[model samples]
Target: MKEIRLAARPVGWPTAETFEIAETPVPEPGPGQVLIRNVYMSVDPYMRGRMNDVKSYMPPFAVGEPLDGGAIGEVVTSHAENVPVGSYVVHSLGWREYSVADAARVRVVDPAAAPTLSAYLGLLGMTGLTAYVGLLDIAQFKEGDTVFVSGAAGAVGSVVGQIARLRGAKRVIGSAGSAEKTRHLIDDLGFDAAFNYKDAPVRDQLRAAAPDGVDVYFDNVGGDHLEAAISTLNKFGRIAMCGAIAQYNDVAPPAAPRNLASAIGKEINLRGFLVGNHSHRMPDFVAEVGGWLRSGRITARETIVDGLENAPEAFLGLLRGDNTGKMVVKLG
Candidate 1:
C-alpha cells in the first residue's frame, strides 16, 4: 500500500516538494476494525488549513503522518460483526490506497442513492451537507429571497445556488473566477445571473446583477466578495460564512471586509459554520437533497483526478480554480 505524507509545512502555497509518497505493507484488520481498499478520496480547500501546525476545529496533519480527508472504500476484511466484508463505507482516511480503521469511525453508504460511490464523498457527503445546512438552516433562506454566492462554481457553492433556486429564491447570482465557470453557473446550474470576478470588481458586478439587493449571501470566497455582498445586502439579510478560500494559503493575515460596517445598520446576520457542528441536520439534508438528486432537480458535477499519487496536484488545482465542481482523486 502507498500513502502520501506531509514532508514540510508550507509558508504560502504548497508545491510538489511539500508531499512525500511512501510504500508500506497493507495491515490486517484487528478486532472491531475493518480493512478497506479505497476507491475514491476528496481533496477540498479545507485540507490546506490542516497542513499548517496550528490549532483549529480539526487537528493539523503531522509532518510524518499520512494526510487524511474524506474517502469511500470497499471493506476487504472486517472483524466487526456489524461491518461485513464487501460493504462500501465512507471514512476520514484518504491520501492512501488502503486503510485500516475501527468500524465505529466508518459509515456505510448506499451507492444506489446516487450515480456513483464517489457521490458519497461529494454530493451526498460533506460537501453537499455543507451547502444544505449553510443555505437552508444557517442563512434561514426563505422563498423569493435574492441570493448571491461567492466561489459560486465550487462544490458547495454550485449546490447552494441550485438549492436556492429550487426552493423558490426569486433570483440566484454567483461569481466565479473564469467566464466558463460563470457560464456554467447560469446555463447549467440554474443561476439567474453570474459574473467573472476576474473581469471586474465584485461590488459592481453584484450591484448590476441584483439591483434590488440580495437577501442571502453564501460566502465561499471571503475577502472582497464578502465586502461586496455586505454592500448589496438588503435589511435583515443573512450571510452564511462557510469558507474563506481566498486567503487559505496566504502567509499574511487576511484583510477584514472593508464594508462589514454596513452589515450593522442593514441588520445583516453573518454566521461562520462547520458542517461537523451540525450533524443533527444530516438526516433532513440527506432526505431533501437526496430527493432532489433522485428526481433530477439537482445535479452532481465532479472533476476526478485518477490515482492517489496525483491527489496533491488535484488539491492544488482546486485552490487554483481549475475544477468545476467537487475535486476527487480516484484510487482504484
Candidate 2:
C-alpha cells in the first residue's frame, strides 16, 4: 500500500514537493478495528490550514506522517463485532490507498443509499452536513429571506444556496471565481443570481447581485468577500462564517472586513462553525437533505482526480478554485 505524507510545512502556497508518496506493507486491523480498502478520498479547503504547524480547531498534520481527511472504503478485513467484512465505511483516514481505522471511528455507509460511494465523502457526508448546518443552523435561515453565498459554486456553498432556495428564500445570490461556475450556480444549482467575483470588487458585485440587500450571507471565502457581505448585509442580517479560503495561503493578516463595526449597529449575527460541534443535527440533516437528494431537488457534483498519487494535485486544485463542487480522489 502507498500513502501520502506531509513532507514539509508550507509558508505560503504549497507545492507538489510538500507531499511524499511512500510504499509500505498494509497493516492488519487490531482489536476493535477494520482494515479498509479506501475508494474515494476528500480534498477540502480546510486541509490547507492543517498544512501549517499551527494550533487550530483540529490538530495540524505532522511532517513525515501520513496525511488524512475523509475517505470511504470497503471493509476488507474486520476485527470488530458489529462491522462485517465487505461492508462500506467512511472515516477520517485519507491520503492513502488503504486505511486501518477503529470500528468506533468509522461510520458504516449503505452502498445503495447514494448514487456513488464518493457521495458519502461529499453531499451525503461531511460536506453536505457543513452546508446544511451552516445555513439552517448557524445562519438561522428563514423563508422569504434574500441570501448571498460566497464561493457559491464549490461543494458547501452550492448546497447552501440550494437548501436556501428549497426552504423558500425570497432570492438566492452567489459569488464564484469564474463565469462557468457562475453559470453552474444559476442554471444548474438554481441560484437566483450569481456573479464572477474577479470581474469587479466583491462589494460592488455583491451589491449588484442583491441590490435590495442580503438577509443571510453564507461565507466560504473570507477577507474581501467578508467585507463585502458585511457592507451589503441588511440590518439584523445573519452570516455563517463557514470558511476563509481566500486568505488560507497568505502570510500576512487579511486587510478587508474592516466594516465589522457595522455589525454592532445592525445587530447582525455572525457565527463561525465547525461541523464537529453540530453532530447532534445529523438525524435531521440526513432526513431532510437525503430526501432532497432522492427527489432530485438537489444535486451532488464532484470533480474527481484518479489515483491516490494524484491526491496532492487535487488538494492544490481545490485551494485554487479549480473544482466546481466537491473534489475527491479515487483510489484503486
Candidate 3:
C-alpha cells in the first residue's frame, strides 16, 4: 500500500517537500476490522491546524506519521460480519492506497444511491454535516433572516448558503477570494449577493451586500472576516465560528478584532464548533440533505485531483482559495 507521510512541518504554506510517499505491504484485517482500498481522500482547511504543534480540539499530527483525514473506499476484506467485502465505506484513513481499521469506525455507503462515492466524503459526509448542524442546531437560524458566509465558495460555506436559501432565508450573501467564485455563489448557488474579499475591505463589502444587516454569519475564514462579520451583525445575531483558514499558518499572533464592542452592544452570540460535537445529529442531517438533493433544492461541487502523490499540492491550493468547493484527491 502506498501512503503519504508528514516529512516535515510547514511554515506559512505547505509544500510538496513537507510530504513523503512510501509503499508497504498491505495488511490483512483482524477481528472486528476491515481493509479498505481507498478511492478518494479529502483535503480540508482545518487539517492545517492539525499540522501545527499548538493545542486544539484535535491532536497535532506527529512527524513521519501518515497524515489522515476523511477517506472513502471499498472494503477489500472484512473480519466483521456487518461490513462485508465489496461494501463501500468512509473513514479517517489518511492519504493511503489502503487502510486497515476497525469496522465500527467506518460508515457504509451505497454508491448506487449517490453514484459518486466521493460525494460521501464531501457533501453527504462531514462537510455537509458541519454546515447543517452549525446553521440549524447551533445557530438556530430562522426563516426570513439574512445570512452571510465567509469562504463562501468552499465546501462547508457553499452548503451553508444553499441550505439557508432552502430554509427560506430572506437573503443570502457570501464572500469569496475571487470574482469567478463570487459569481458562482450568486449565479449558481442562489446567493442573493456575493463579493470578492480582495475587491474591498471585508466590512465594506459585507455592508454593501447585506444592507439590511446580517442575522446569521457562517464564519469559515476567521481573522479579518470574523472582524467584518462582528461589525455588521445585527442585534441578536448568531455566529457559527466554523474555521479560521486565514490564520491557520500564521507563526505570529493574528490581529485582534477591533469591533468586539459590536458583539457586546448587539448581544451577538459567536460560538466555535467542531463537527464531532454534532455527530449525534448525522442521521437526521443525512436524511434532510438527501431529500433536498433529490428534490433539486440543493447542489454540490467538487475539485478533484487525480493521485495520492498530489495530495499535498491539492491541500495547499485549498488553503490559497484555489478550489471552488470540496477538494478531494482520488487514489489510484
Candidate 1 lDDT score relative to the true structure: 0.93
The window of 10 residues in a row where model 1 has the poorest summed lDDT is: 253-262
TM-score of each: 0.98, 0.99, 0.98
Task: Identify the runs in model 2 with alpha carbons over 4 angstroms from their true place.
Answer: none
| TM-score of candidate 3 versus the correct structure, residues matched by position | 0.98
Give the clashing residue pairs of candidate 3, or none.
none
lDDT of 2 by residue, 266-330 (tens): 89999999999998888899999999999999996789999999999999999999998899999
List, residue by residue over 201-298, the lDDT tens digit for candidate 3.
99899998888999999989889988988888899999998998888878898885778877888999999888998899998988989999878788
Q: Model 3 residue 227 lDDT?
A: 91
All candidates: CA RMSD (Å): 0.9, 0.7, 0.9
- Candidates sorted by TM-score, best first: 2, 1, 3
